[model samples]
Target chain A: MDWQIIVDSIPALLEGMGLTVQLTLISLVAGFFLAIPLGVMRLSSNVLLSSPVLGYVFFFRGTPLLVQIFLIYYGSGQFRPVLQEWGLWEFFREAYFCALLTLILNTAAYTTEIFRGGIQAVPHGEVEAARACGMSGFTLYRRIILPKALRLALPAYSNEVVFLFQSTSLVSIITLMDLTGVARVIVARTFDVYEIYITAGLMYLVVTYGILWVFRTVEFRLSGHLRDRALDPVEALKLHP
Target chain B: MFDLKGYGWMLWEGLSITIMVGFLSLLLAMAMGLIGAWGKLSRNKAANLTATTYTTVIRGIPELLLLLIIFYGTPTLIQNTAERMGFDIRLDFNPFIAGILTLGFIYGAFATEVFRGAFLAIPKGQGEAAYAMGMSRMLAFRRILLPQMWRFALPGLGNVWMVLIKATALVSVIGLEELMRKSYIAMGAIKLPFTLFFAAAMMYLAITAVSMLGQRYIERWANRGIRRA
Candidate 1:
């Protein structure tokens, strides 16, 4: 009901959005790059390679992201001496670094499973055709496997993106001034709880739909060939094998 | 290290509350999911609109944001509105109650889709057959449709459960004495943050692993006598 309070808090909340956006993007992009190789490696017959990746994905997926964030941020402080000796303390010491690392690793683990499923979902006949053309190793994956798999992974990846964006709120518990943290601080300052929260929730709603819109557009483009395009029933039957 | 610096007992207690909250929320979610699915599948435009809006709004926001709003914002709004109407009253919610309701309401949106899919997966002929056998509508739904719907709904419901259990951790933010909160308290007390959090993480993983096993067992039972393609 108090418009003035929400109006006054806009600057701080917008500033907090910067960190929220940064955290989501950094985590998602890093997770995507790491997941590509991990996805391929997971399907390999070599137990030594696949098992570790399997364990990594299992551990991260099985546990909550909050625990992962706390473990990295607060838990790492317990090993300050060792980190200090290895020159890694500088990176682990900051809350932002710990939060970012946690987000990246958590997303990477989940995305690996999605990407692996995508790879497996890639048609067996397509792989066979690629092999018949002597496309092996890098050529096979790059030219045939990865492309189709990435398309298959898009919808799941979009879900992950929404989850990751929302999960970024967990970083606020670690003292980062992200959007949720900013809203929390304002609510504590001005007792207009509904106004502040409603504002933040609206902002989140807008961003969520925006992300979905982008994904929908991309999905349509990627899978366009699979959809029918106004062909007559008899003509469509003729095109079918 | 896993002794949790002698604070293991507290973790055990917290785990009990966490599981309690998880199940209670699951119960509420299933109830809402069923109602929402009914509204969605019904021919009434108003019911369909209401169901769509509920799922859309909840899915758009983060669970923590919704939990915080319900825990802190709801009572304030109620008090404000009461004052404007010339009534003086106070309302406060226990964090436990707030958490269960918020999570139930949030995940219910997801469960709505799952239930709707399950309902649609059943062939219309099954219900028609029930009616032809002189069964009432309610009896047909209860005896014929519901059991078959479960078989279709299991996998999606399992996914919802996994997310729900993990989501109960967010209740710690509202000061609920769940596993995550207890671990935080112990971390502050013993200063062995790594050991305490790692133990909590392992406990959570154990719960999820056990849930997965139970899910698989139930999946087998629910799917008994059905052939897979």
Candidate 2:
């Protein structure tokens, strides 16, 4: 209800928002690329190709993001000598680097699972059609499967992106001044917990809706052919997200 | 590297607390989810709007923020209300109670979607047939709808449980000595963050892996005598 306090907090909060957005976008892009091969491996018929990816996915998805962050961030310190000898200590030493790495690894696993589902859900006929055209295995995956899989995976992938965005807040626990972190700092100083948190939550809500809007537009464009042209946009938006 | 450093009992106690928190939250979430599903599936406009708002707002915010809000907001809100009523007394949130309530509320929004989907999956004719057999509305729901809904709801509920259990880790932020908190403490005590946290991670993975196997058996039991699609 302290309207002025919420207003006073926006500038600082927006600065925090910058970090959140940075972490989310970087990790999502990195994770997506990492997931592509991981996903393909996950769907491979060969156990050797698939099982390692399975273990990676199983471990990441099975544990909490917080634990992973702590494990990577603080855990690396325990291996300082090894990391230093390997010249990897510099990377693990920065909280930002550790947080980003954790988010990337975490999102990659979830994205791999989502991508695998999308690939598996791709019609067999399509793959067969490409094969009949003498498309090589790599070419077949590139031209036929990846496109459809990406399209099919968009909604789930978008959810992952949004989740990743929300998750960037956790970086604050290790001293990254993300949006939630800024709000927490302000609240600690001012004791205006409700007002500050509400403002932060509203900021997150706006970004969440914005992400949904972008994804809906992309989804609409990607799957336009499969959808009935006469169906209203409002109706389509209601189906998911 | 695999040593627990005499903190094995600490972890066991913490794991029990973690499971307790997760279980209590799941129960509360199930209750809310059922009500939310009813509200969503109901014809009443107000009920539908309320359920929709709950899910939308909860889903839109980060779980950490929501947990923080409840952890800090509850006592403050209570005191302000009491002040307005001419009596002011401070009330502190028991971290366990706070943890379960926030997690339950958050996951309930998710479970609402799960329950709604499950309810929608049930055939209309099955309920109609139950009614035709002279079952009252309540009887039809209990005898016909609930069981079938359970079958359809299992996989989604399984996913919810997976997420919810991991989410219990967030509760550690509010001073709860759950697995994550205990791991942090042990890590500090032993100066072995990698070993302790890795051990903690495996403990979590064990919980989820076992739950998955349990889910498979439960799914089988839930779908007993049903034709596979």
Write down the lDDT of every candidate, Cα atoms only. 0.90, 0.91
Place model 1 in a CAPRI quality band: medium
lDDT per residue (tens digit) for residues B147-179 in model 2: 889888899999899999999999999999999
Model 2 DockQ reads 0.78
Strongest candidate by DockQ: 2
Q: What is the TM-score of candidate 2? A: 0.96
Off by over 4 Å in 2: A229-241, B131-136
Candidate 1 lDDT by residue in tens digits, B115-204: 988998999999999999999988998999998999999998998999999999999999999999999998888989999989989999
Candidate chain B TM-scores, in order: 0.96, 0.96
Model 1: residues >4 Å from true position, as ranges?
A229-241, B133-136
Which residue pairs clash within candidate 2? Answer: none
Candidate 1: C-alpha lDDT: 0.90
Model 1 DockQ (Cα-based): 0.60
Least well predicted 10-residue stretch by lDDT in candidate 2 chain A: A230-239
